[model samples]
Target chain A: MGRRILFITTDQQRFDALGCNGGTVARTPVIDSLARDGINYTRAHPQNVVCMPSRSTMVTGQHVATHGVWMNGVALPEDAPSIALTLRQAGYRTALVGKAHFEPLLDPFLRFAENRMGRDGTHSEMFTMPDGSVVPHRGFDHMEFAGHGAAGNLHYVGWLRSEHPEVMGKFVPNLDGDLEVTTEPGGDTMAPQVRTTNDVPRGWYHTEWVADRTIAWLDSMGQDDDWFCWMSFPDPHHPWDPPQSELHRVDWRDLDLPAGYIADHEEREKVLASKPAHWMGWYDGSFVSNYEAPLKWVPATLQPDQVREINAMVHVKNELIDEAVGRVLASLRARGWDDDVDIVFTTDHGEMQGDFGLLFKGPYHVDSLMRLPLIWRPAKSAGIAPATVTAPVGHVSLAATFASIAGLPRPDYTEAPALPVNDDDARERGFERVLTEWDSVLFGKEVGVRTIFRDNWTCSAMLPGTLHDGTEGELYDHANDPLQRVNRWDDPSVRSLRDDMLADMWDHLPSVVSPRRTCDAPV
Target chain B: MAYIRRDIHIARTPAEVWGFLGEPARLHEWFPISGCRVEGTKRWIDLPTGITFEEDIHLVDNHQRRFVYSIVNNMLIKDHFGILDVVDDGHGHSIVTYSTQCTPNVLALVTAGAAGQGLAKAKRILEGGN
Candidate 1:
């Protein structure tokens, strides 16, 4: 019998947030246990730093260039080939439960048109064809959506209204609201930390709802049935709200400054000046500001204490995620299917998490933002030893890996290499370098950035005139400065290394002859 | 949320118009899906994108020349009900009025676009435009 696959993904979780990955703040024992029992890839990177592109890559096994979801606001083509479709064709039951940010929440198609017609409602559900057979979204036979906000999330909100009406009215809008305000140590102005403690009971939390539905689905499946489930969690991403019960599970007073945060502005300015114009704009509040803006630039006036408080909330969010994961695992064990299932735990992209004085992510593809924590636990019968793989891998390899685990022929359209799951010495034989791309129009300027990570050296370059009048780049020796504090692109010592990496990145550039236009269909 | 209703007069008979509009299986020819299946009063449609929608057919009256259906258990829409009425204009022509009500009423455009395209195609095929 094919092993049941339980794939879990978290949004905006950093690589170092797990205890198993040497994180000091977050308490992620359930996730840490997965690393202890499974194979952990320490240096896995996302093909793109943003949500939509990275998720599209994960499902389609195609790079952002091929999938055409290079940035937000673009939807993945309905007919695009997906891993879920491949697995279903091979007779495996597939389902996706949780956040699927495949399309922008505020798509123009969903907007009201002058003709009094528009596609209302979020397009996260399965599209019905004329025939009797239901087309699985991307290829999942069943989908349960629980998006970011209550207003946009139809399924979760419906449940909340029926099950916890009072809490829904009181807490849904304020999920991201600041519950506490305090004056910075010396500053006269109060810097409000965006954090909330949910009054809704633990059982009604979205995380628990996801676990409950997923477990109910698993229970309905026969013991002999083969299945592939993508249980995505929307938390630890933003709106930094954890249930009051889970928030108390972790003491915020125990948290400290993130590893790479440079509290000194003078030192930060020196580091920022050495990089591209967009990077400087992010620190100085010129490129983008405010959370609602499409371009996600950090505020320059953000205090260090505020950063610490946000990180503390992030840790609490991680704790809640861990508990949810634990409940799902326990359900699997109760059904006596734990031994027959293979689990993959990872995140879409990393959060800045106070790295280099930045809180969130944008054009910057620093290690803290690009690197991901990927752990794979095979079925007990596979007998794969728990070991750390230091080789470079990216989200592009997921579809191919899922196909391999299902014992099915890999689809012909996938561009990613099949992950080395069975090979015990895979780390020693992994890719020498991995590539990630970014293409978006930010601040009325089109920006394209690409980074090539080779061992301990990271190099990033921006397209000419995208950010400023001239082309710009950044190089960092992670071996000495893992926090990416200094840019050494012009340093004589690493010029040759930088040149080689840049050449490789240029070769990997996707050739664009004609970009695919958005679908103009009325629906 | 928005609302839209369109009435079109076609140079065809009501029976000829209902022949295409009443049959769920012919949805793909004019609508977006590839094919549709109807069991009792419930119809399920298959779109080109591989997703499916379950719609309940409320009224399929040949005498009244009206067809009513509502989408149920759909992710993108709620409380969606659609009505298609075909009336003999007493001059050997048929007038079809398509109306829809749904939450986030902006969906009126989707219904309008589909109705506009479907009715145009039905008129053409009935009047030998295809």
Candidate 2:
């Protein structure tokens, strides 16, 4: 057995959210330090933007097709091999400490854990109550996690009432339906009893429990070991709110709302403008007009004040996670394994924290969710790559990279390893041409493709006008507009460029996999 | 000692599904466990008042979904399964189902409701074709 491996992933962590990448410093020293010593791939993107699918991509280097974890209620492809199997085969102890949303396909390798039920989520929290009632929040061996689909705002349950009386009536699951989230009474809630405000001194939040458990595991390891461990965070995902203390830090007066604050009268004619407004009661997220909506979590533009509060909340969250990262690293060093172990740090996806005047993350592939960060600390012998990979890449590389490090062989079923991870000059291998694609959404999700360039020439193709809802064809020349504020789809000069991108997207389809063969694009 | 057993070829392998089920955070992704929240060390207070409950995963039979854990918080139900039995049936697939009787919580009336929901989610998760 070689040195132990520590893999930690943050929930909804954006690529630009890190200090090394000019992500707001609010406070990410530990993560930044990890980047300083490791080879940071500036252009790593997720194979699947959502939790379940993205996690599948992380375990299997191949896209959704090969690994078979395409939808929420789907199982992993029977033939597909996961990273854990390979590691165990190689004689290393493999343990996943937190958030492993490889659902529908139930994480089969969980048997390796001496312990189970680390993180908490909606489905995991569902349980059979004492009185023999169907209670939400099932999976965790411990109790903590609530909600269904996107309805459980982590606050109050729709049907299940909390034992603590003081928090009663503080949360209403049925209150928010603007976006069709599944609300249930049987779930975990964060109301007056457990306010999500960034206020509590740092260690009291739920994230603290996660980190404490995972770090303790690392602390318990001995030098005679080679192990693979994963720690996943659930925050910065939803229920965005100003930490009571951090609230108003960025007042509406100080913030610049996205172009799509709320749909204009005319825009309302196209999509249901009030849909997002109604959902505000259930979630805490904000996005801009140009913000892309995801099929899973629908995005909504927020009130100017709501936007400021959400932004402050986002910052405070980063601070919290940053501290958690610092603590983990301190403990790693204390164990005398810091310099020896390989550390992988990154997130599931990015949160649209009011950037596009929208709150929370949607199913669409906006730069917010699709373009997440991938930071890796190379082994002592392997050199680190410094510049950002301007090329396009997919999230599938997580498994490929880890497998390569452990010298594990690739499984026979995955879509294909999209990119190769390198200790040195790896950024050069980032992406020749990256393509972004979406699976079947609720009835109708824009099933299109996006191609990004090192030079920032971006093209997206879906249903016509998807640029707003699920439209078709968006072209952006980022050199002139770094924020991608303008879409030049109609630009005459880019006629040939548009054709080229379309061809690239169509060609890349074969490489990405989709679980729902029914919704899969015809070859 | 009665158990209902069947085998199906889930799109992903046992290892993959195990990865999904291994973490408590992933329950909401499938099986409709509904809402959840973790408190204290291992005590999980489910909502809608089924009575407080606590459970712990004591060991794993790696070859099988056969995990041994005790349901204690509620005390009313002594539902426990030691072997998950996640093995290939040799018919181009594998079988993973537990055969444990629910001890029933305070609401003995709804015990079956909870059990049915859990098993249904497991079936959908294990057999869903992504």
Candidate 3:
């Protein structure tokens, strides 16, 4: 038997959401312990600050341009290189048991196989390929998918409909009749993505279901087999709805405003105006660049209490996710696979979460949307030191890292090197800069953005768009302005620095895909 | 006549983005249609919802990076003409525009929305790599 790999990911989580990451709100002891005894990444960023692109990068270790899933609606090609597939080929049992956003969630006619899995009422059982070959779905020998809510033809939805059918309506309807995300105001704050009194029991919540299903999959594997299980949790993302029984964990009235949030409307507007036009455009309802942002909910109308409420909901949801992680770890311990398992904990991307009075995320390149809380707890038998890695890293390096953990050769298609331990290790491995990009055409508006993070400074280069010419962009020095309240893109002192960063970013970017795929679903 | 225009700047050469626009058989690659069949200057597009549109290809100007077509047999459309143009943005990128003019402005809204999505997808395909 070899060291097992357990990859756990949360959706749309911020760097400051964990206790070890200086987050005072969410008491995430389970993950914080991983940081205490493992390698904690302080400057990890996603290649793309969205779900499908970031998740694709994680699985393939390829850039957005390389994988070609540039935006949400576009699906990652079925035959795209997958870390699970690579590990499976290396004789490891692989399974992904949670939110696999590799395919868009907006499939009405079940065009994509991911959405069609549970359409016939069989959930998570091995699916047969179109050619009648009983192959692994995207490299996972077994799979189960759970999204934010009961919206899609997912395994979790099927289970809920069969076993706990009455609680099905407890979830806010994720999509409307047009197959678009519903923007109905929910919860006491009247926030568009919030649902206050979701009466779903804690046991029936998708978070618990994901953990349970992961444990079941692990239990099914032989004790001597080397396994790679990606236990993804689809919570703390949107609809801000945790099980009502667990909402008592955090109180909105007791919570303070997030550090990135500017309470004063005028001051927030001032900060937003300093950045790119889309920041203010999305906040003031002048433009809608991405379908992720709720159409009916105006950021300008977001109240301070609503931010507090949303933060509280996210905190409660985080605690639930932490508990879920603890339960899964307990399962590993019970199976005696604890010390031989390497656990990597991270998220797809960060949420805006009332940063500068912004609720959701879009093309913004600030830390709120870019920085991720990444922790890698290698197997105790590996004899690696626990240290803080400050050098820049991107989610694109995960596949190679998994390959290294599995003692297999890195696939030729994987781009980045394996994960590094400390600043010196990272520097030695040439892990100096992390790149993030945003290119989306939404609501008849096109936005093109490329960002590079290096030397504690973040720089973004915006292409010509409806609001401004290509000259507009954002530059922030984390050493001084950690919250990124001000932009220095146009500053004379940082002109050379910004120009160099932009040059490096553009020069390093991979070529874009021709004849890009269409976004079938609003998600 | 109701007129609608939508343009997207793709990070590719004008000619590369124009390839999908100018070719009738490649219409399904970027547009909302599920399949496309061409018979000489006449083309038929099948939507994912099972509706088919019969159209006549007006022009395919390779030098100008422009494509023009019109619906000849459709009950709901009444009269429709569509034009797609890919122009060089001078920054090694191309600005692809899709415009449509048709009777009954309400129908143009649907065409405009679909064109907007198609243009966005076109930009992604033109700029994204496998």
Candidate 4:
């Protein structure tokens, strides 16, 4: 029998958002404890910065190019090889208990049906078998779809209707829409806006609901049956809305301004000018014409106080998630499965958290949005000692790592290596460099960016445009400037190093373009 | 509350337009569902995602060239009803109108997009003789 695998992911969490990871303001003791007991990969980076592609890579062990979910609107193919399917084949009962952004919430087919049907029932039946068991979509035997908003959240919305109808009434109209309510606009293009606070009660919050449902699922599992569960939480992501009860967990007065950020416009302009033109345009509101206007949350201006308040709300959301994780962990222990379960804790992608004068993520591949916290805690009997690894690993390796941990044969389609769990010299095992890609498909921009993180240098270049425009690239010497305030792509001294990194990135590109598929395809 | 209305000019008589739109089986052809199963006035629409939804027919008036239906027992919507009307344009052409009323105003955009697409498909098939 294999150990039960508990794969937990939070949305839009930063690498340094945990207290154990040196987050000064975040109160994440539960997640911090996971790092204390597990192997923490300090330099883990996601293959893509957005939600869909990054999550797709985590499950399929394929890059964005191979998976073809270059942006959020695209869906991961149901036939794609997944870790959940591989584990199910190994006799493990697989279940996903939270947000699976594999499919677009507003897909034309789903929207049309919902409009015609007048009711959005638990769409889980779509993924169910004739015997009433779930027909695994990408390998998970059961799915509890609690998406970000009530508009498309099947499970969470059902719970809300049954439990807290009043709260549902207030949130449903604006469900899944932009969470940020502009209370006070930034006077200029560099200031942040003061946003509204979250109003849901602590008990009815999605974070608590996800945890409660996950614990219930675990309790239902047989004593001898091994299970694989992905407990995904949708919070600490956006809307920056933390429940009123959880808001006091972190005080806004105690918060500090983001590192690598100063209020000086000239200094910020100098930093933004050194990178891609679209980034600066996003910051200054010039790029709104090029992309979907409503989806753009990046404000042209932000005040220091607004940024601090947003950070405070983010910390509160993090603490709430930590509390939820603690409950799930307690449930596992109560079932006497603590010693027989392997736990993997990570996020879909990193949040800027006001880093580098930026609040949300965009075309830029800065470390704040690219780097993620990767922690693995093997069962006590696995004989893997706890230690922090500094090697550069990509989220693309997670599917392979899950297979290796479950004692299954490696899937043939994956290009990622199994995570180095027991190896003391994991960094020396050729896990030195990671390639990150950004296809401007979502924003409808003409530029595509690819970045390589090797050694202490991060090199990024815009495809097609970088060849003609000298300024369309960025090179950061992270060793000297950890905050990445300086761009050295044009620096005469590191030209050779940049070229080598670019060649490595080109070498890792997919040889053939993989076609995208709908999630409803027959297996 | 959200309201969505889509009107298309089809090169067919009002009776011909209502004949195709009123029949549940013909409705499935122009609607986005891959297939549908009908039990009296209730239809179980099968989507590409494999999920099926139940739509109850509230009224079907052939003389008025109007059909009315409502989606019942749905979680995401409240007081949701749809109406499809066909009127003669006096030029041997018919003007087809599809309208919906639902709560949670954001769904209006979704309903509008889907209705526009469905109507466009119906116009193409009717005019192109497909």
Candidate 5:
């Protein structure tokens, strides 16, 4: 039989959230061990920083512009190319058990199949689109959907309501009475969307529920069957409400501020001022660029104590996710599949997590939102030595890698090649730069941002939009300013380098889909 | 009525910036409109989303570098007024201001966002990038 694949993904997690990635706050021994045993990618990024777009890139192995899921609230086309579908076509059992955000989660009329499946409890049934193509529900033979909170038509919400009705009140209500993401703030610091206490027991929380469902799905497969399973965790995203029982993992009062956060207000504003105009505009509440962040929440109003509390909650969530991963790996070991599974662990994108006093992510193209923690542990039986790759790679390379693991020919629809094993392999394979793009027209305010990460430099060019003209941009030398505290876009010293990078980026960008997709929902 | 007024400073002469804003036919050069047509004091503009607006030009004074227009037709708008001004800041720079007022209140936000983008694009073009 061919090697098995276990792809684990987390939502809105930082690159430094695990111990192997210099994260001292959360103990992620399970994921850290995976990095130690296999390849640890130091400079991996996503094609888009938001959930729907980045997740679309992961499944399709295509750039954001090509997939046309350029922002949240835009549903990926039903028949878009998918690696999961490719694996199933190769005679492998495939199942995606948690948090499949390939479709927008804000569907109210059940127009999208993902929400329809959740609403009708038909996750196991293969769905046929209006085009009469009967596919395995986005290429998965079985699927289960879970999101951040007790809102939407996610299967977790239905399961929670049906199986354990008592704990339904524990989670912070994600949607308000108007059926929008709730901006309610109730905690020690009154941070927006921050609920301090969630009384749901650890075992019944969505994190554990995801792992349990994945195990049950795995147990259903035959002993000799080759399979691909995606165990996606919806934690560490937002409304930081891990079960109250696990809050003791980290104390808010005892943690240090993130290295990216400038403690002094003026210093933070000065740093923000160096970048695009929207940075300070978002902080001071002068402009609302996107709907992903809480509208009523201003970054300038974020208190230091609130940053501590939020980080503590995120660390707690990370800890829970690690334990859940441990549980699933244990289940694999029990089935004697641990040694044969090519495991890939990563997140859709990184969170701001109090970086520069900002709490959520938007069009910001710095490392806080762009860099991802990616680790690929090849099957032990394959005997690939462990190494750290410092080259740039992106979500666009994931599908080809999956196809490689299955011993199948790379699909013609895939864009990038399989990921490199080490730095030398990356250099030999021409994996030199990674590109990320952002385009949003929320609240009638349009913003377009493009970034290129190459060598030790990061350059972002802002298109003509509400906040910035085409002339404004940011340039940060990662080797000197790892925290991206300064911008040298206009500096005469690096003008040549910045111009070259921007030229390369625009030349490399794929032609965007015309008559661009519309935003059906806010999220 | 809801109101919004935004200004941006460009390191260019007022006449230089007004060279692009003085003519009604060049509305799409900086604004988000895809195409526009002018017939004397009446004008029609098309947005990229295929929505068209019929406007009445109230004033166009090149000496003052000021232009004003109001949308006269559209069920979605109750009252819409827009003004663009480019004034010499007396230090070899020009300060361009764009203001909008609309009755639906939410529509003013839409116009305000477009005005912000339009003003930024004008600055970029006058200061030298395409």
Candidate 6:
């Protein structure tokens, strides 16, 4: 019988963000336990750095480019064979509960909820609700909206904040009001619940409650039969709202500013002129100098206040999510599935809350948005334990790994092959020689986005056409300057490394669609 | 130094309020938008060191708990003034106050709604007596 796989995914989580991965404040006891018991792959990449593309890659094991879903307008093709389909075909009953952004709001996925029209149309970018909450595009199966005030946009993936209070499953009034705030958007992102009474949830909260339902589902399933489940959380994303005690854990004054918190006025102007997209909001399309952007959006120059609020939100949400994970694991053990399943923890993308003086996830290939949290554990008794695969691995490989874990074969139609899940020694043995290539961020099939990563070497391509060998590329030895705060694009010493890497880039670019690349390769 | 304050409240103790007028140096405490600061002269506050912001004393009312001040680099703030008064109705006392009279700049005009949160938050914090 195939081993059951329990995949736990969180929203906007960065890879090296846990205590196990050197994070100073992040509390991920459950994840840490999994790492101690099993493998802790240090190098894992998301298919894309944005929610839509990254998730599409995760669901189908296809690159963002191949998945064909970009920002809001793009949609995943219906015919695309998903991981669920493959696992279902292999007799592994699969259930996806929570933020799988790629799941269609219509048809099969849409059938899971009552408010299908509002949910599907919003995600597809075709939903037309005049004068509704302008933030359309909430990417979840079951959505209980809280804060959106009728502009008809699913701008945020939050719960009806008013109801979230109840969904939280706990409350402490003596707590600071901010601590009580749930990222679920109790009222609207901007306005809060006047009477904490509205903070209650009526069964539509997608965060904690989602885990509750997910746990319940696992219990009802047959123990002897194998099952595959993907549980995703919507936070630590934004409005940085979480139940009080959780939100209060991190004071607003405690948030560490992101390196790229705010861009220079010139750069800010350039991005604003382009009117870059945001998670639940956006900058005015006009050119805006760094000074003009709101303090909340610019982490670099966050007003002393925004820094506090943002940190409070992120810190608390992380704790809440950690708690949720604990609940899932405890339930799994109780249901007798703990010893027979593999739990994969991950996230869709990372949020640049206020990095680069920018408000949302921008089109940058930097590690901030690229590196995503990923951890996997096999049941202790299963004896299928493998060492942490440290070689740089992509999200696409996960599909094949899932298939391989379930004793199924790699799908014949894929651009990339399945990465080996051999024992730790084997992974270590192959690290140096493994195929390591970071795909360029595709701004669609038209533009060439940069790709950088490797021990200390970084590469940037102008895209569409270029080679590091004078065609047009930038290289930096990040060993000395980790921030990549400096650019040695013009530095002369590392020309040879650039030459070799550039050649590798040219060879790496597939002439046409491989039918293999998923969402431009993630963290 | 032009920001928008969508609503207006005028209080009597403008001068006394200035004594405790919110400052920019420790901004994260009162404002909902400001939360944490890691590095800077106006760094994030904690139990050891609290959040504070320096306000350019714009206006003051001593009799009432009210004052107007601006952060150092103010663009999104036009003029913010608060009006407050504590009243005694024989048996007990009550407080009435108006909050956040700053005008938002052009950029603030769009996402300024987050500031409305500031007004409501300010009122509760100041008058809640705790």
Which candidate number would show the highest lDDT if scored against the true structure? 5
Q: What residue runs in model 2 are displaced by over 4 Å at the alpha carbon? A: A73-79, A104-201, A241-301, A381-388, A409-430, A443-455, A463-471, A511-523, B1-130
Prediction RMSDs, each to the true structure = 10.7, 13.5, 7.5, 8.4, 12.0, 19.6
Instruction: For candidate 4, write residues A340-362 as lDDT tens digits.
Output: 89999999888766666667676
TM-score per candidate, chains pooled: 0.74, 0.62, 0.82, 0.77, 0.80, 0.59
Residue range A1-523, candidate 6, lDDT tens digits? 6688888878777665676776666677878888777767665666556565677677677765555664322345545546766776677666666555453221211221212433432322222223342222222222332111211112122233333333433321211222111223132123211112224332343467667767876776886878887777766665444554344365555556655554365565454333212211234332222111222322333343454355455665676677788988898888777777888887766665555444435444455666666677876665755566656666776787688778888876454555545545435544322122223322211223445455446566554422223244445555575444445555677777766766665565334334432221111
True contacts kept of each: 0.05, 0.00, 0.00, 0.19, 0.00, 0.00
DockQ of each: 0.05, 0.03, 0.06, 0.12, 0.02, 0.01
Clashing pairs in 4: A119-B74, A189-A300, A189-A301, A190-A301, A190-A302, A191-A301, A191-A302, A191-A303, A192-A302, A192-A303
Q: Candidates 1 and 2: which is better by TM-score?
A: 1
Candidates 1 and 6, the one with greater DockQ? 1
Quick one: best DockQ, which candidate?
4
DockQ of 3: 0.06
Q: Which stretches of candidate 6 lie over 4 Å from their true place?
A: A70-72, A103-205, A255-301, A353-359, A382-386, A419-448, A464-474, A511-523, B1-130
Better of 1 and 5 by DockQ: 1
At residue A194, what lDDT does model 3 achieve?
82
Tens digit per residue, CA lDDT, model 5, B90-112: 99789988888876554565566
lDDT of 3 by residue, A82-179 (tens): 89878987899988888998986755334566776755644443445455555566788888888888766788988998899988888878755433
User: How many Å off is the CA of A264 in candidate 1?
Assistant: 1.0
RMSD of 4: 8.4
Question: What would you estimate as the lDDT of candidate 3?
Answer: 0.85
All candidates in order of TM-score, best leading = 3, 5, 4, 1, 2, 6
Docking class of 1: incorrect
Instruction: Predict model 5's lDDT versus the native.
Output: 0.87
Alpha-carbon runs more than 4 Å astray in model 1 = A107-134, A169-193, A289-298, A422-430, A516-523, B1-130
